[model samples]
Target: MREISFSVQALTAGYGNIPVVRDVTFTLPKGTILTLIGPNGAGKSTILRTISGQLSVLSGTVMICGKALSGLSPAALAREMSLLLTDRVRPEMMTCFEVAAMGRYPYTGRFGRLTAGDRQIVRSALARVHADDLAEQDFLAVSDGQRQRVLLARALAQEPKILILDEPTSYLDIRQKIELLSILLEEARERQLTIVMSLHEIDLAEKVSDLVMGIRDSCVFCSGTPEEIFAGDTIRHLYGIQEGTFLTRTGSIELPRTRGNSRIFVVGGAGFGLPFYRALTRKRIPFSAGILFENDLEYGTALSLAVRVHSVPAFARTMETAFGEAEKDLLACQAVLDAGTRIGETNAANARLLASARSAGIPVWRTIHEQD
Candidate 1:
């Protein structure tokens, strides 16, 4: 087993005498990533702040490398952990390189000037985050995403054993989000750095985290492996998501299913039906969908959008009974949509449904954009 890098024991943290999150306990093994997730105002940030020593712990303890946080000097703590906080930073007249170079303060001499090796480390950190282009740009002038990357580069320059981030991806686009997290993943693996961060993107968190901690109702709601935390209705209930469905397998969310009787029938499979289902849902057109295997990529979206759905076991041949039910639904509808599912032995029922729709004089559409 890997050495434990950080541990939180029955911690309660917040401002002043009040507690925002209580009884949060977890341990981070070397090179592991733990993510905190919850709805807004659930104290995810508070937990991070407390652990990073930016805020006082109202109760309990935080230990880094078996040493209590309270016992460590500021410089020692800085050497052990680095943080990228959500707090806005505006360094006047400083370039991005200067901002990032500040992270080496713990190792700098009294004069605090960067040595040649320190400068190289700063450059390497910027390159690691793909922010080398922004090095010459004025720190205050960069976009939020660029600033975030620079801040992360700064934290990396600290070369701490642990990294704590608060909503690090908040300002990042999808591509930047993936790139930044990928860098963190690589660093954790190669450097054996422990990572603790709070994220609003539960889907991304699920993908990157080894352990997931859910904060809710001023306490640690739950903590476990991603497989344990993301299973079933855990995510849905954690976020109090009543308006839509959360698909655990794909970590994708779908809007609430359209209510009332379905007027249109959609024949889709092999992950081709997702866009059509979403388009119909946006148009507020309640539709029925059929002949999807439980393992289909679009199955979750179909369940959330379609008023009714016909599905068979994953990897199993489409049952005749399911096809018959789908055919009946198709015949009752005035129109049918063929989502361009590939015709194969396993999904041959979809082809039959399309043919049946044509025979019944129900207009069959190859795409959602087709004219009536």
Candidate 2:
């Protein structure tokens, strides 16, 4: 088994003698990636600040490598852990290189001068984050995305055993978010670095976390593997999400289906119906979709956005009874939409539905844009 990196026991933490988070606890092994998730003001940042030794622990204990958090000196703590928080660092006269090199201060001598070895590590860190080009530029003048990468580089240059981040992906674009998280994963895998962070992007959190802890009501509400935490309305309840539901299979979110009048019958399956469903939802056009296999890629979205979905077991044949029901619904609808689902030998019933719609003089739209 890997060594335990950090342990929190019955910790009550906040600023200035008041506790914002109470009785939080977890143990992470070396190389473990743990994510804290919840709605805003759930004390995730407070918990992170306390464990990282930036804020005082109101009660209980925090241990890093078997050493008490309060017992470790500033230099000792810096050597053991690094942070990239929402807080901005504006170094007036420092270049990005100098700001990044500050991460080596834990190892620097009394005068805080960097040797050739330290400079090399700093450069390598900048390159790892693809910010080497900005090394000569002033830290304060870079864009937020570039600044985020530089801060990450600084944290990496620290080469600490544990990293604490709060909303580390803030101000990052989609591509930057992917690259930064991928780099963190690589670091954790190759260097045995333990990570504890809070992310608003639960989808990315679900993908990257080894252990997920849900923080709410000023305490640790749920802590388990990502599978356990993300399974079945747990996140919905965790965040009190009323607008849309969380999709477990794909780790995505979908807006609620409209219940207004003028329903449209849709024939969709095999991932072909996603855009049509979203477009309908965006237009506030209520729809009933059907004939999807339970394992279809868009099944979750269909479930969330469709007023009533007709589905069959994955790999099972579409029976005549289902076809009869769908045809009835189709004829009763104002129109039918064909999401361009292929009519294979198994799902050829959908083709009959389309034919039935045309027979009844109901509009058979080959594309949703026809109605648009």
Candidate 2 lowest-lDDT run of ten:
363-372
TM-score of each: 0.94, 0.96
Question: What lDDT would candidate 1 get against the real structure?
Answer: 0.89
lDDT of 1 at 342: 68
Candidate 1: give the clashing pairs.
none
lDDT of 2: 0.89
Tens digits of per-residue lDDT for model 1, 318-338: 556588888888898888988
Which ranges of candidate 1 are over 4 A from the true structure? 368-372
- Candidate 1 lDDT at 7 equals 95
